[model samples]
Target: MPFKTEEMLLNVGPQHPSTHGVLHLEVTTDGELVTNAEPTIGYLHRCFEKYAETLTYQQIIPYTDRLDYLSSMNNNFGFVVAVEKLMGISVCERAERIRVIMAELNRIASHLMFIGSFSNDLGAMTPFLWCFRDREEILKIFEEVSGARLLYNYYRIGGLAADLTPGIEDRIHSFLNQFEAHMLELDDLFTRNAIVIARLKGVGMIPRETAIAYGLSGPMLRASGVDWDCRRDEPYSIYPSLRFEVPVGGEKLGALGDCYARYLVRRAEIDQSVSLVRQCLTDIPPGDVKEQVKRNVRPPVGEVYVRTENPRGEIGFYLRSDGSTKPSRVKVRAPSFCNMSVFNRISKDILVADMIAILGSVDIVLGEIDR
Candidate 1:
């Protein structure tokens, strides 16, 4: 006689480590295989958009820091650009270079967190330690310039909160020199491990078309072989002046658009971010970093939508001003929320263990999703 089977429901977390944040994965399973996995968000409900209306333009800067706490600098970059566009204010050359440098450094820091956390999710504890060790170097640099390590509300509507601190570039260059060698060590220890390959290769595959239809972005989109990046395609700030490669997944890395592809793509982006930071450091000009503007200057009655590339993906802000210091309307196009929409589609009929792998690969930060 054939074996009997029964279906069951499993909750991955609103508190579990595998869920990455305050996210719940409702997984329906038949024995060990997951039939479907649906994500339940909103454990951290930060009403950033609603609050934007109540607060002045400058006050909203600190709030954006909470959206994707990992990519706070990039979040600041996107919002300030939107306000600047609405006001028709162009920042100085020095400030623009500094903006790109800070944003790219944050990108590196964010990816390091992803590497560390993703490794921890997969049961490899040492790579997680190694990642955090190197990541601390970047955080030190951020703290020196912005005066805070994680949530640096350092970008401004017209320029930056402050100019780059003296000798910061030398410190960054020193970190980059060591970080490159360290990444190769990480590659040997984690990326090429036989056990990791068996666990991730050919698992949770999303075809290029499906990724596009589902509106994925950042590493999620690029890993599926999409040649799109908001920084390069939609140039903003000093990104047009920077040179870097957009990494994509394919046969060279592993199976196209699989869980492994997502991992590999993010790994490659770290190198590109390092290069971007170096370029900004090399040619940064001298000028007043801040453009003189009122502390509560009002924008002309207008609406503008601006998108910038964050470490997670494209972060766009829609700002409508009624000639007031506070915006009348503010909406965010959060990349993680868009990327999470496709999870259930690819997650069906995989092993429950594989579901965990897929979720880690998604790298969802619940703060942004719930916000």
Candidate 2:
């Protein structure tokens, strides 16, 4: 078996739909097995960071939305948090509660696509349509609040774009109630489905230590038995005041941190998000959501890095200000970019089709990766 084989080179994307958003994998294979895989990115790059230097702080918020477009609210939160930290602004209690609601809702939206696309990759088409059906509700909420369906640009430096329109809270409440049923349906349909379980349970086994060493975070890290979460560990934006559990790895995984483990971890996190949103609805106070900042914007001449747990992982921004109208430099440390790096190491010895499943489970947005 070792004597007569030749390695065949295969180019898998940059145009192929299965590669998922302009991702190109240069795969080297021996027969049906992948021997080496390298991810090629930058295709979707829009130079958002460089563009940030020229725009006012407020102008850059929409650009962040485009990064992880599926979780635009989360992106809005991250960009605004960095600017708020720079300007020494803290959001009010009501604003904090609303931010949590929006962020968690976006998390649900992003993960639904994960469940849908992951199953779809395995030849299950119905899940994709069902996922969009539920996710449409989330987009509707975003549209009502921010006046845009996808890229909301809803967060201001010190607060949000506007207070929730009347009945928005009630709508969110209704949506969450229905949302719980959707998660349960999803679990019944796929999480425990025999085919999905068999294909993903022990596949793509990334260990706890390897995950940490590779800088994995979010569900990926949690699935590897690490209990660290930026929401729980380094709390910001009222997360410190909320009550929620960080769902880590469980025994069903056989201590094998595989794709299924990550999937289950996110599934459980969605439930936790539901609980958190309900709590916010109960405890939210009545007040001005925005902090009244000086009409002109300026920050001290210094650099600071702020990181938060996005649905993908720890999304951080390194911001440098020169006490001017614009930031001197802005560097976005996207989690997908870091997590996707693990693909080359993890995909070795897997089949091409299995590689697609693993990639979808990783749940990367190429816009964020390429930005």
Candidate 3:
């Protein structure tokens, strides 16, 4: 029996908890099936690129922190790496080790947030609390090091703001010792749950071609069976020396491009980050990790783009300097912005409920998207 159903316009965003941030989804649906969905952005726009034009190279570091607040340390890492490359300068090995430590720890913290919030979006509340419980430990580490929790203005042009505090290594090691155990508990409770598998598996499939065509990076691309990580492929800082596994969509883990694949890739990444942090903690050489270089950092009159692996995706900074205290051009290639592009295409003809699951898997942070 055929039933008469008319297309209707629905708005899921700008205020909805699941849209992730100040994002609006203009969705057209027929009954419970969606025909089209598009994203409306800029509600959280802060004019970061335009504002960077007036601020010095060093002054813009804090602004990058705002782009992806959950991965503030990695945001700082990407920007400074770009600035350092632009200026043709390098920091000491100790600073590099410390930088890697902070970035990887931030990676772990950010991924934990993803697991929690993404699980919460799927109606699993226990994983949310458990993930955040461990994330708090990372926040405490950041606070003791950078004096700020959310938006850390720590990384400088050629070095860091300061050295690791005494016994912080012990603190991180202690946290890691238990975080692994908690992850196992989560694995038993949520990862292998029949409900979670039913909700995520084989839905929101982004084939390898579609993923590459949309310029997807990080876990989004890897989840679609593409094994490319900017940290490994485009070696920068101390990543070339770190040994870690890059998880892709595999038979044993997740089928290609599905939401479950995305989840598995990120879950595996957390363990790799744990290995990285442990590596750095054990071998941080002694050095003067001060706010190296003066406030006025003038690079040569040239342009360079530096890309680093962020929790969401690849974060690239395209910087143009005029041999002055400030940059003439600063453009950011935010990963969430690119990852969000393919949402509507994959959304067509799917149930409205599945659309929500797809969006959650995208894991966008509107701060970066709007910028």
Candidate 4:
């Protein structure tokens, strides 16, 4: 006679600590194994797209900041670039380099948060504190440049709101030097820890085909052995001039598409971002940060779609203009939203603990998902 067990339903909260931010996971379990996992969102919905339609193109930048609150600079970059494309305006050379520097710094900062939070979810508390320590340094730089730490409305339609604040470049160079050493310490502390390796390796494996079908991007897609990166594949702004390798995951640290692979990809990206920032610093030309963009900020009656490589993944903006100062329609292709959709599929048949590992690996920010 076979052993009999009953399935159980568990709600992992729109309030659970590990759900990250106001996300609820309706999980079905058979003993310790998860039978299915369904993500329930909308707890933090601010209707950013709707707000964008009502506000001026310049005003919509702050709304984007809330979408991926961790990667506000990249969010600002994507929206401004889309509007600039629609208006046929080119930002000055210095502005382009500054944008790249800020975006890459934000990328490192965002990944640091992921490193901390993901490790904490796995029950290692040390990494969480260490990662935050490094992240705070990046936030300080942001605060100095933009006058706000979290929601930086720094990027304008044609250029940045202002050039890098005085002594900001020196501060950035100093931070980078310190951050590089800390990254190595992080690798030793968590990446190679035997227990962490065992927990992450061979868990929550999403095949390359499945990942692509689900529209996974960033480290999630790359962890499944995909070589596509928006920064390299779809060159924009000053990215084409910069030198950096896009990290792809495949048998480097365990099986392809496992939680470990995803973690490794993000780990590698921090190094790449550092390199990009260094390049931007060395090659940044001097010119007026703000271009001769029209004050009214009205675009021709047309639509434009722009995508950029955010820390989470590809953040896309679709803007439709009706010859008005405000966007007629604004639709955001948030990476966290697309990445989260694949959770239920990958979480099926995994252990409850493994489900957490998978969730952490995906790195979904509820702000972007519910926006």
Candidate 4 local accuracy as lDDT? 0.90
Whole-model Cα lDDT per candidate?
0.89, 0.86, 0.91, 0.90
Give lDDT tens digits, candidate 2, residues 77-171.
Answer: 98888888887778788888888898998888888888777788888887888889989998999899889888888877887788989988889
- Please, what is the TM-score per model? 0.98, 0.96, 0.98, 0.98
Top TM-score hit? 3
Worst 10 residues of 3 by lDDT: 283-292
Estimate the overall C-alpha local distance difference test score of candidate 3: 0.91
Residue 267's C-alpha lDDT in candidate 4? 95
lDDT of 4 by residue, 118-232 (tens): 9999999999999999899999999998889888988988888888887788889998999899989988999999999999999988999999999999999999999999999
Clashing pairs for predicted structure model 3, backbone only: none
lDDT of each residue in 1-371, candidate 1, tens digit only: 99887889988888998888888888899888889888888889977788889999999999999999999999999999989899988998899999988898898888989888888888989988998998899889889999999999999889889888888989999999999999999999999999888999988898999999988899999989898998999888878877888898986767799988899999999999899988889868889877578889799998898988888888889989999888999999999999899999998888888888888888888888989
lDDT per residue as tens, model 3, 111-160: 98898889888888889999889999999999999999899889998889
lDDT for model 1, please: 0.89
- The CA lDDT at 144 in model 4 is 90
